[model samples]
Target: MNDEKISVDNRDYVGALASGLEVLSAFDVQHKKMTLSEVAQITGMDRAKARRLLLTLHALGYIAKDGREFRLTPKVLRLGYAFNASNDHLDVVQHYLQSVTSELGESCSLSILDNDEIIYLVRSSAAHRLMSINITPGTRLPAAYTSMGRVLLAQLSAAEQKDWLARAQLLEHTDNSIVDKNRFVNMLKDVKQQGFCVVDQELELGLRSIAVPVFDYQGKLLGAANISTNSLRVSMQSLIDKYLPALQDAAKSITAHAK
Candidate 1:
């Protein structure tokens, strides 16, 4: 560790690398295409610094530029590819997800919490239409309003969860979205007690899901898995009663031999 050049050594600040990665991360599902000014505004970085980072990213082929706006290109996928290749466990998790989808005839996903958001690491679809947005390995969703989010959050300690809840600004994506602190806290507790979570029409109308946590052999929380389906196609009660078991089973499968 002494060889590591961290910020406190009267040298380069760790914040610089973090800020550069943040600039890359800011380009996501919604903010895929943005101008230098847009990146500056979104990331709160000065316009000059944002421009430098964007230009560097573009030159490195992680991004593409056309006129005033810039967007991520296929080269950006290399980052994800590298991550997937490095983590051999994701393949095992993906296989479990595929099994769950095959068994339940529903869409299944393996996701990990990332910076207060959930990123789908692997997803298997059962040919049934679900959320309006496409669900794929790279798909990202808000951690606050998703069953997977709640399930992953449930894995956190009570004190850490409270700290997260305090800073979180709950967005009302739909009328049913829970924005109240007490109710949200209570719901997280319920998720912990039940060992699973269900979100009904909170993320999107007709989009219902159930999620269970996946752990590693050493009992470390690895991630969460979920099955998402359309409400019209499957009743909420059935999702909780029927799909929940399948999802939890898949979680166990992923944990049993994830690598």
Candidate 2:
């Protein structure tokens, strides 16, 4: 099992529960509704196991079955809601994110690192969209290719960051994307020292962003906050000189108020 190593040293881990959640996660935006066979293939599980898990989820109201196709139900939203409800600090982050968007006339978002991706929890979008895909709350983007992801990664310990780089599948999203592991690690070190990160059209052709990590009252990492814009409209120097100061102030305010 992919998660077996996670539980290897921890006796409290429940592999079955982990596998069940893995099965549910297989049904994403691209695979909104899938058959048992499709779910099995995506989860790397056998048909019988996948069927069992799906049926269990269906019975529990987390999934719905329409003939041979299965899709998630509204009940599944409780899982994500539970996290948001527990983290009340996110409300503070969202307030500051909206302020950044209002001041800069660009999109700003708050995201947290999840596995190898950064999941947006709060997003204040501008009238103009920067990418083909609509980026809203719940959108997940590759952490290594995003400014917000790099800011969060910069918060990790040296050994943790090194391990992530060694295990990550470096895909080049664009000509500017950093695919070299050593180079990316070095960039993370620079981000750590500078207290911010800038990704210039690395993930999407016209999208450029700058991010800084936000901390809680106890200096614990809360998440990353970023301002995103189209490269043609906003020059890199403008981002550093004009927008960076505003973002940094917002981050400091968010951290101070995060209780």
RMSD, one per candidate, in order: 2.6, 3.0
Candidate 2 per-residue lDDT, tens place, 131-175, comes to 888898888899998999999999999988988888898898899
Clash totals for all candidate models: 0, 0
The lDDT per prediction is 0.86, 0.91
Runs in model 1 deviating more than 4 A are: 1-12
What residue pairs clash in candidate 2, if any at all? Answer: none
Q: Which one is best on lDDT? A: 2
User: By TM-score, who's the top model here?
Assistant: 2
Which tens-of-lDDT digit does each residue in 193-218 have in candidate 1?
Answer: 98988898998988888888898767
- Model 1 per-residue lDDT at 66: 88
Error of 1 at 22 (Å): 1.5
Clashing pairs in 1: none
